[model samples]
Target: MTTTTSDGVATTRPAGQQPDPAHGPGTATRPRGRRAALRPGSHLFLVLTAAYFMLPVWWLVVAATKSNTALFDGAHGSMWFDDDVSFVDNLVQLSTRSDGIFWRWMGNSLFYAVTSGVGATVLAVLAGYGFAVYRFRGRNLAFSILLGAVMVPPTALVIPTFVMLANAGLTDTRWAVVLPSLLNPLGVYLMRVYIQDSIPPELLEAARVDGAGELRIFARVVLPLLRPAVVTVLLLTMVAAWNNYFLPLAMLNDPDLLPITVGLGQWQRLSSVGSGGEQVWNLVVTGALVSVVPLVVAFLCLQRYWRGGLTMGGVK
Candidate 1:
């Protein structure tokens, strides 16, 4: 069939068919799009990934509430809480163990993490900005060294670092742990990349034209733009410092100076040895749970910055 409009343009269609104004070809396509959007394997993978990460945390929470006997007993499932609620009792025991030294370990961890995190952030920003913005002698060689440093396993350098610290008479001191954490090559590299991509050179030129010095330009202009990268380096260095084990173990023999990682290993050993008929399994479990709380809280508090860092820092 054919029809003519006022403009005398002819159209053809099936004898009894008319076009629906609202639902054209899209009516058929919308259903296909909806079907294509829902992938069973993708949903399954997401569910499994979430469970894989969450199950250990759930076990920790459950295990913290149980007594050592219940924790080891086959009667209760590891995924759920037993009838006994011993979190408060475990806290008391953990606090009093070794004359309140566990709290001291916690304090030491906080100090090291915060101090090294700040120092690493500062140094990384300065070095990375310089690498990205400046032209200097041996610039490529220096950055190549940094990238090579990133590839070297930190564990491989622990012995050398310990020897250097010992020679300087800084072994067994808080500086032993903190000083090593300040030189994060990965942080410098990340900052350099972030600055190169996100910051415009014209802005720096304008700042320089207005009589702003390099330090002033960095402190005022570039730093604000690098907030995401700075936060990223801060969190990475802090987590590394907090969870550090081998360096402190190699450097310090003093129990009072030990971070939670080494200190908890001591408790774990004591738990296994059953020295003086005292079992520390409960204390170790509780302490592990307690130790994780700070990092979790930190992540929650600064998660917005973390998310922004992922977007801006090319981490995603």
Candidate 2:
């Protein structure tokens, strides 16, 4: 006999035999629904992971609001705000301290990060597109070298970079920082992989067939599809440039050219000196809090592109 199952699929069975539970109509749907459900343990793990990451940020926020005395005294403990709320005072101190040099450091960081990030992103996109699309001599060999470069730790190269910059008489200048920051092998690799996976060669061929030149085809067709990867690489390069410490430290000796990372380190070292040193921990903490705001804003602004990319990938 034939009967319609719950999924509307018709099945045949013997006259007196019941449907087999293993091959029942709703069995497939049941497993799918079950697979979608999260167990209590999974929920617990997610909550714990979130807390682990957020706890330090929470402490930083609370510490930023506390007075120097309260910060060291543990009066309200470390995780909660002190009653006095010196956040405004800290900002004022940060603004006026050292002839408002903190703002200069911030401006330096902004310049380095933006210039390097844009340059790096442009290079990565171009190189990645070329690697993904065109078949050139030594393409695989060049990519292999790039992959090897990515495996080498960036810190390992700082000394050699400093030596090179010194040889070129570029040390202690902004170029020393910006120039080194522009070479992001990992970003290039990421873009290459993303382009290969997301952009089809047929689309480019179609654009060419429609009488589009290489430049026009890239700008009109390929670039629009590369938004997500572009944003990702931009953010990564910007953050890397902004947070760069060792390279800048080794390269720049002038206080006026220091980025926030090295500037803060200077303050920290001064604070650590025994009796003759000044204690500017409040300014340091406040400066750190302020430095983090730009990056957080960048992430918030660019997060939609990431979500959209994931959604598009899922659809494809």
Best by lDDT: 2
User: Which pairs clash in model 2?
Assistant: none
Of candidate 2, the 10-residue stretch with the lowest lDDT total is 12-21
Clash pairs for candidate 1 = none
- Model 1 C-alpha lDDT per residue in residues 1-316, reported as the tens digit of each score: 2346458975432211123323433244466666778788999999999999999898888888888888888356888888878889889988998899999999999999999999998999899999999999999999999998888998888899999999999999999998988889988887887788668899999999999999999999998877756777788788888988888889888999999999999888877753654677888889999999988998877765554444433332
Candidate 1's TM-score = 0.82
Please, what are the lDDT tens digits per residue for candidate 2 over residues 257-289? 999999999998888868467898888899999
